[model samples]
Target: MSRKRVAEPGPLSEHVPGRKKACWGILTSQGSWADRSPLHEAASQGRLLALRTLLAQGYHTNIVTIDHVSPLHEACLSGHVACVRALINAGANVNAATIDGATPLYNCCASGSAACMELLLQNGAHTHTTHAHFPSALHEACKRGYSQCVESLLSHGADPDYGVAHLGSALYMSCLHRHTECSRILLHSGAKVNVGRDSDSPLHAAVRQDSADQASVLLDYGADVYLRDSNNQRAVELAPPGGKTHQLLLTFEVAPRTLCQLCRLHIRTVIGPSRLKQLPVLPLPSLLTHYLEYT
Candidate 1:
């Protein structure tokens, strides 16, 4: 988006003696006319003086773009700590979400801006709010391996088990983004290592994400090796072809048990077809819950 640059002058011109209006000349030069907010432009360009001036003159800190991206989102993206602080002090809603439901904290953390993240969190930002448009800030932090920021959000009650639009959980995101250390932290902090959401298990995420370290961590934390994704692919099948990570899964085996074909097939449908063959045969009993646990 483009914004009009107002000439540098004091706000609100007062009437002087009558003067003739100057005739305007259209420049055939390179530029085209633009339409956007002065405040938004200033914030986006990190023009601290203009931003501060606007804020001081009572320009709205809560101004947003057509897409509902906030000034805070711009400030965080521009790495303008001073502008961010000024906007927050000017009573900007620190937790304000964009049109996509991404909060300022989510933007800050996603951009790897630890200082901005701390400021947002200290100023009462919502670490637990999930974005229907995408993953939460904890997921962003974990995905990016922003360990310090991750710790900060976790301290402020960010849920390790939080799920979002495509990402299953913080653990899932960490795996997907290949942030091995962050995955380890979340798992140690009580993230469900074996759970799936939106039909994606951590094993599925790890293999698809090409994260050997994260996959190992998940296995150590009891990730189900035989778990499957929506595509009917096992974790082993998801692994990159010809690698130690692939070999590791090939070596790990679950003990065998006999199960009814219908129940087993139903479980396979829930999990995936590729995993069905790996499952041990189960015994016949009035099936209440057909799932089995190696532990």
Candidate 2:
């Protein structure tokens, strides 16, 4: 990536005569965020040495552009762990939000930066945002199939099934995007298999996306095949004829649940999803432990 030339002092100075050509880097108005300071540039470009120099010179770490985006937000968005660490160490607010409700933590979630997420969480960045207008960090992580980020958010107390205004549950987003691993993580973390946007179940999303693997995972977690969506369509109705998903659904519909499968489900219910990780050490037979943990 070509680095943009830096204009001195402030963002407004870029409009000065004769500086127009050289200032093209930020000429786009810092990606339209507006009024970004030198700190934002250093952070966004991952210029760690220059950024540290700026911080040493007493530049404000928490300074915001017109959109209220801090240097930490810039660093997190770019997935620059060094710049993020420098900003946080210099007192940048980890929880600072843009005007549109994007926080530094949210940027980290979008970038799939698990290290940045852990650092932010340790600094008190909220795992769950009360921003009704924006997708939660968990939702972003799952939607992008950032499985590590998903696990980190879940470990930090993010609600697995918290629905956004229009994005539905994190499980639904994962299933809709065909991210089977994310969907599995959500299910194992106690996300309700059937609760989704309005009426579209995770199974419906899986079927619509034609992800037979996701459909199988959701079924194992007890997703209902006969559930109706906003359009009153069941999962089978959404599956393409003769598709992998269609075949799987038809087979499932034809056969009853196996005794072993029911036993596994019942055992998982008794153990609880939160404590499933403890199954390996329960002093039971290895086969039984594997069955419970689905190892």
Tens digit per residue, CA lDDT, model 2, 1-295: 1123323534447557755332322334333333667888899999999999988987678876666778898889889998888888888888887777888888887899999898898888988777687647888888889999998888887877788969888898999899899998888877788988888788998898899999999988777788888888889889999999999999999885789988888778777756776777788999898776666
How many Å off is the CA of 21 in candidate 1? 19
Q: For each candidate, what TM-score against the reference?
A: 0.67, 0.84
lDDT of 1 at 78: 67
lDDT of 1: 0.68
Question: lDDT: which candidate is best?
Answer: 2
Error of 2 at 22 (Å): 22
- In candidate 1, clashing pairs total 7
Taking every candidate in turn, the Cα RMSD to the unseen true structure, in Å, is: 11.5, 5.9
> How close to the true structure is residue 161 of candidate 1, measured as C-alpha lDDT?
75
Segments in model 2 whose C-alpha atoms lie over 4 Å from true places? 1-34, 270-273, 277-286
**Residue range 217-243, candidate 1, lDDT tens digits:** 777666777766788778999778888
